[model samples]
Target: MTTPPQPPERYTQLKAVGLLIGGISSFQIGATLAKGLFPLFGPSGMVGLRVCLAALILLTIWRPLPGQLNKKTLMLLLPYGLSIAVMNFCFYIALVRLPLGIVVALEFTGPLTLALTGSRRVLDLCWASFVILGLYLLLRPESAAHGNLHSLDPVGIAAALLSGCGWIVYILTGTRIGRTLPAGLATTLGMSTAGIILLPCLIPTLPLIATHPWQGGAALSVAVLSSAVPYILDMMAMRRLKPRDLGILLSMEPMLGAISGLLFLGENLSSARWVGVLCIVTASAGNVLTSPRNTHH
Candidate 1:
């Protein structure tokens, strides 16, 4: 009866919510974990390890055919893989110099901008304004817990901004790639492609890993937490969501980043910083709540 459809609909919504929460939490925690590796392996090296390890993990399961190098797959895969590499690399580099919460908050502008771009709704604009104010507070040096705001390095800021740009590319390409290819197969190949692209940059780190096998294992663990798990969840969630709604859900990332930073990296924030986090959470939540309810699987 009516309960039949209701149960399935309820299940789908629950699954989406679960995936969103799981994906964001796993990604932020893993990001916090990556900070430990900065001293041993540079950001580029870590990015290299993430892709290569994740590629290896996924390949074991999906085992995509090497012979199927169709032109269309090539076109979709390149931008998608490179975008991931750039996004993660820059974010890690920024994390090395900046607090995780601030870096993630600033980097969020890309996906938030994309979500708000064409919306005619006046409230959406209001939410966008909230995000702006949040960014202002976040990036403002005075808001840093450290008494001196100048400690916010420009190189880290620039790298984080570039990471945002990479995220924009990732969302655009990944939305298409996610739908077009089988989930595991697409991720495996795409990660392999990204690893290949990053090979040149990884030479320095290779020696470190060779000297300490633990470094390789550490990177593999990060890959599992950050890339493999969340990626598979993202594909499942995307099947049930529009790219727009999905991007909006990512607004939670900065707040989660802040929490993870505090818990793991001891990156404390002052009252103004707290307000900024509140604003972002509010804006993102409001936007998602007001988004259209109808979704496809």
Candidate 2:
């Protein structure tokens, strides 16, 4: 009888996991840097600067040829760029007003919702229930014993919700366009488009650098850490892992963000908020564990 075929290499699985963790960690650190810079540039200025600098860095690296892509590709990329722009803008707005942990937890809902939307699995319903519990804990009004809810700004909450919507759009667009283009090229062009769209906003703020060099420096740091570094790492990671594995790895971002915010920004959450975090984390982890190993896409 013919010998059986050998099993796949274990090293590949290990390497993929490592890449995913590295990507998520890079993103968390980037968010922490952005939060630190918020006081200087405000949300809009910081996001604009981040996109512009990221576009420059990625363009240098990818050097995607102009006019090479067809109209079909451009049509797909338009919403992708818009989603990225809006996601960054709203996330910064929330970051400026809320604790980092809270903002991240809120944003986690976006991808979680996307994952559960079309699934008919019973386990998916379980995940949905936990997510609902987490949201309730995060958004519920504080009781007298818990003190005031004044720290939770309504406008900031709204902005965070909008950010979640943008993230959903990003996920959908990624599913469509990511397959057709290389990750590096797609990311570079998408960010470049966003930067160009925001150019008008930057014109007014560019003069502030002369009078406020410190603010300019802060903005530069945010651009480097939040946009360029994370984007590059994410592109690298995407090459190693399947989409489901990547999603599972990204679930760790909120926890990493919470830790970074605690260490660097002195941001803290209440006991209830911690519970909410646990709920969301459990839901994500459970989904990943239950998913099949053969499910590549």
All models, RMSD in angstroms: 2.9, 3.3
Query: Best candidate, TM-score-wise?
Result: 2
For candidate 2, write residues 195-260 as lDDT tens digits: 888776566668877788887776776677777776766666676677677767777777777777
The model with the greatest lDDT is 1
For candidate 1, lDDT tens digit of each residue in 207-272?
898898986788778988898889878778877766556756776788888889999999988778
Tell me the lDDT of model 2 at 1.
90
lDDT value, residue 238 of candidate 1: 74
The estimated TM-scores of all candidates read 0.87, 0.88
Candidate 1 residue 74 Cα shift, in angstroms, is 1.2
Stretch of 10 with least lDDT, candidate 2: 3-12
Model 1: CA > 4 A from native: 1-16, 66-68, 143-151, 237-249, 293-297
